[model samples]
Target chain A: MRVFITDTTLRKGMQSASLELTYEKRKELFFLLSSTGIHELEVGVPAHSEEERDYIKYLARSQHGDKVIVWNRANIRDVEASLECSVKKLEIAIPVSDFMIKEKLNKDRDYIVRLLKEIIPYVKSKKLYLSVGFEDVSRADREFVIKLLECIREEGADRVRLSDTVGVLNPLQTNELVKTASSFLDVEVHFHNDFGMATANSITAFLSGAKYINASLLGLGERCGITPLEEVVFYLQLIQGVHTGINVKRLYEIVNYFIDMTNIHLAPNKPLIGKNAFTNKSSIHIDGLTKSKRTYLPFDPEVVGSKAALAFGLYSEKANKLCKK
Target chain B: MRVFITDTTLRKGMQSASLELTYEKRKELFFLLSSTGIHELEVGVPAHSEEERDYIKYLARSQHGDKVIVWNRANIRDVEASLECSVKKLEIAIPVSDFMIKEKLNKDRDYIVRLLKEIIPYVKSKKLYLSVGFEDVSRADREFVIKLLECIREEGADRVRLSDTVGVLNPLQTNELVKTASSFLDVEVHFHNDFGMATANSITAFLSGAKYINASLLGLGERCGITPLEEVVFYLQLIQGVHTGINVKRLYEIVNYFIDMTNIHLAPNKPLIGKNAFTNKSSIHIDGLTKSKRTYLPFDPEVVGSKAALAFGLYSEKANKLCKK
Candidate 1:
């Protein structure tokens, strides 16, 4: 099955302490990501600031403008701010878990139900493609989620975003959650990498019939970040035999662009885009590379527009002997 | 089901360019890992260097000598080196995939069959507990893997290790392979994180009846590294209700110790151990944390010997209002 990618690098990626992109860099990143053939680009929360709102406005008028999705809290003021940006698409996020509703939002489920009754029709009336995000869905009661899904469907929303806000669910759990949500509406997913399973969970969600996958460059976001765009894109293309329209060749350029714009130092062993992802240091791997690249190489580094090479390390003497042989 | 952890920080973790522990630091790390209640510690490859052999020998004579497992090639010389160290346990590693056997090892499957015929009995005869590692099994033919498993079991080996050398397998694939191998003998898993699925795959292998999981601190190893010990242990204990006998509270200390010893900088969003793994930055997350920690946290950070806190960022204005309320 094919998967659709919604790159949220500019929005969720910017909220973290690790990355802060200027307006020009944000515009540059938008264009760079647009070239990658991703389905949508979640640019920013218009309600966050006037600058953020203005940036959303600017991006809405830029090339590939239809792909821009403005993020907003499920509130009238946030919806008004997004409307001001003239964005065609909006993702209205609200806490669905009782923990989040009672503690964070200081509201009840009825408050959300009533709010949705007013906001959903209002946003749809303006001809915006509405995507409702259930924040902290991982901890939400299953029955409550089903009830909300029915409510969301009745409101004529285009899709539902199940957000694992804290990145707690495993692939099996993610599969079940996506299955439950997909039964009612088109499903989008936003997974965080808190337990280092975001990529796997994102892939599982897609396998369970998710139509949209939210990811970020280098998995940049709050806390442990979200599913990395590079890992999800390449894994889908190479391992699962699922084609996401992302230009696999441009991944390195996009990753490098993000790093350059943010001055963040990625570990050399970072999946797909790390400097050493294609480098072989062990003698066994080197010998394999020397004879047939398939032994230790999963796929050609060139598949992602990168190169593979050998290096000297603790196993150099053995590698040297193999070479001599 | 209970899972056994084999911490390979001193062996696989040191192999990556990201970490090069000094001899003193290596000894320090050994004790640090020892204190964490890990089942076994893969100290080093004895044949790699005289220094590594000496370190293994030193560790063998240390307090937790029985927990040390010396890694070796499936050759007498490597076995001889380990025997000299007086390490009671050994993990004999060899290329098992046709790609690795024909290309890297420059040997046929018959050659490996003959080698194992000699090596397995020879090591077992020494009264050494043995674990045989099949490198690059992710790409190995299913029939060949079963043939090897049958051969390995016939050779009187204690266990078999399925090394996903290039991290190509996903959770579903891992479950099937672990199931296959478990039918013949006790199964141990060594997964690479090339696609960011090592932690999930390792967990899946355990769930599918693998007794041992080989993990490195920070997932450091050749090319994208292996599963991170922190993620695997915490996931088992907190999420799956599987007690791994590892002291979860010491994970932070051990991770920090590794960083301090190696002078490596981990990303603040590195799963489980990052600086921001417990820090909430976004106003939505902060508001949740201010009300109920569970609103945004997957688990109490103190479960892993850490604390959670909020930070001011782009959404501080909204967060400030939430705090006032």
Candidate 2:
């Protein structure tokens, strides 16, 4: 029943078009998200720049509840860089699917499994909390994912992540994958929104017993972004009756801040935090709300630090007509 | 194995903020959708105004593969308005949930059942094709839904719609509801994206033997909106191996056209049709694509009449660094 969110806003969120967030903006997002009860922040790639290393060190040294985690390739060099910054947690991702292993790394599945066996012992020896991510596991063989999970589990890796790297998994598949994987080890699901099922798939994975769910603010990521952090928290609270200890009433306030910092325009129709996510427009809907807010709204907007309103122009006109009648 | 899409762009999409499509714009959109092989189009609400009547008439009389469906309340005047336009198909949605039937309509479920019994014969007498939609069916009692469906079937309704009116149902619930209802009759799922799972729910419903899925251009509707037509078709095609007979290559074209006509801003991360849906940004992803596009991309962009490119700034910089090394 315990579900923790790992925020990748600093890593994946920065990959958006012209969304290179400054160090100050990163700190601001980290502070806001940390207060909202997110369990971990995948802060930055310390292997990238000296500034990134310093920022990771700063976040690690900060008095936030969020466990500052660093993203690294499945190589010792990236882990060494992160270790130099005093980062205690690391997520080492390796391409696992045949397509990715062969094409991306010019290597095969055995090469990746061997590489994991090679790099994981050093990470464990460094006394770093470790999560081994099987990148593109959605396309990889289930046996390989299970074998890799077992391999990591034996190697003293604390957690395992099965990434829908290309965002191709349907909900049913997502549920089955996580259900099977969780039986073996602590499973996390890192989903992308390429086909727009990431939020639902994340819910499925969580319901199937994945302990950790990876999300990004505003669903920002490489292409279509990941499952949104707000959406995961909102759905979990309302749909599944699960509490993540997050201050959901601060959801929109934090999302708006992220949007302001990134300069990315938010879709008004986005769930929970969108401008119209709680706005009642149609006269029929407004009239229904006048009698019962639950008539048109699924949940109270106050849960997300927002409120419902009768959409100004036409709703007023409709009310006028009803009055005359 | 059959999943038919009913596009409601002209009807629900018009409810978007300040989105009033001119007659010419509507006509253009209608032609574009028709060309893309969408099975049905829920044209404008002819009962709304005289202009709406003319627009419905124009679309109904036009040559296309789409069956023109007119939306009506659980009353006869709306049907008569549609009949005047020679509309061949009708979707009469009645509130089925206790909350909607009692609070919104100020009537009980039985009243709605009797009302359906009263108005359905007249619609049949007009020799129009009929589909009875149970608005808010997801919240209604299951037995009540079954009884109402039996009532509609007895009244000779052609199809039935089970709406998650407030977007309350999750994917598992969506599948069960649609599955159980489909056992009795032809069931279509009308989902709202209030929970941001409409596309997944729609896919679930379809996979669970529901025959029809109601969608919109950009998922436009009353609040958060319905499942986006593009996401449904894309998921069905790529993930489920289902052929939609859709010219998916024209997916982005129609979406861009809808945006241009409505002046609504498109989300950069929107699945299938967003500006960033096919854009590759991550340096690691771009590096992988250099070996094979299949490494990172799920489907070819040409399938949707789009192209993929390395994200402008950082991806280029990564390639430059690699070249210098």
Scored by lDDT, model 2 comes in at: 0.82
Clashing pairs in 1: none
Candidate 1 residues lying further than 4 Å off, grouped into runs, are A318-325, B319-325
Candidate 2 to native Cα RMSD, angstroms? 2.3
- Please give me the DockQ of candidate 2 compared with the native complex: 0.60
Error of 1 at A84 (Å): 2.5
lDDT of 1 by residue, B1-325 (tens): 6889999988887667556567778888888899989999998888888888888889999999999998898999999999999999999998887877877767899998899999999999999999999988888889988999999899999999999988988877787899989999999999999899999888888878899999989998887889999999998999789989988888778788767767776777889887777777787777667677787778998777788966656656656676667
Give me the runs in candidate 2 sitting further than 4 Å from their true place: A312-325, B312-317, B320-325
User: Residue-wise lDDT of candidate 2 within A201-240, one digit each (tens)?
Assistant: 8888888889999998878887788889888888888767
Lowest lDDT 10-residue stretch of candidate 2 chain A: A310-319
Best by lDDT: 1
Q: Which pairs clash in model 2?
A: none
What is the Cα-based TM-score of model 1?
A: 0.94
The lDDT per prediction is 0.86, 0.82
The C-alpha RMSD of each candidate to the native structure, in angstroms, is 2.5, 2.3
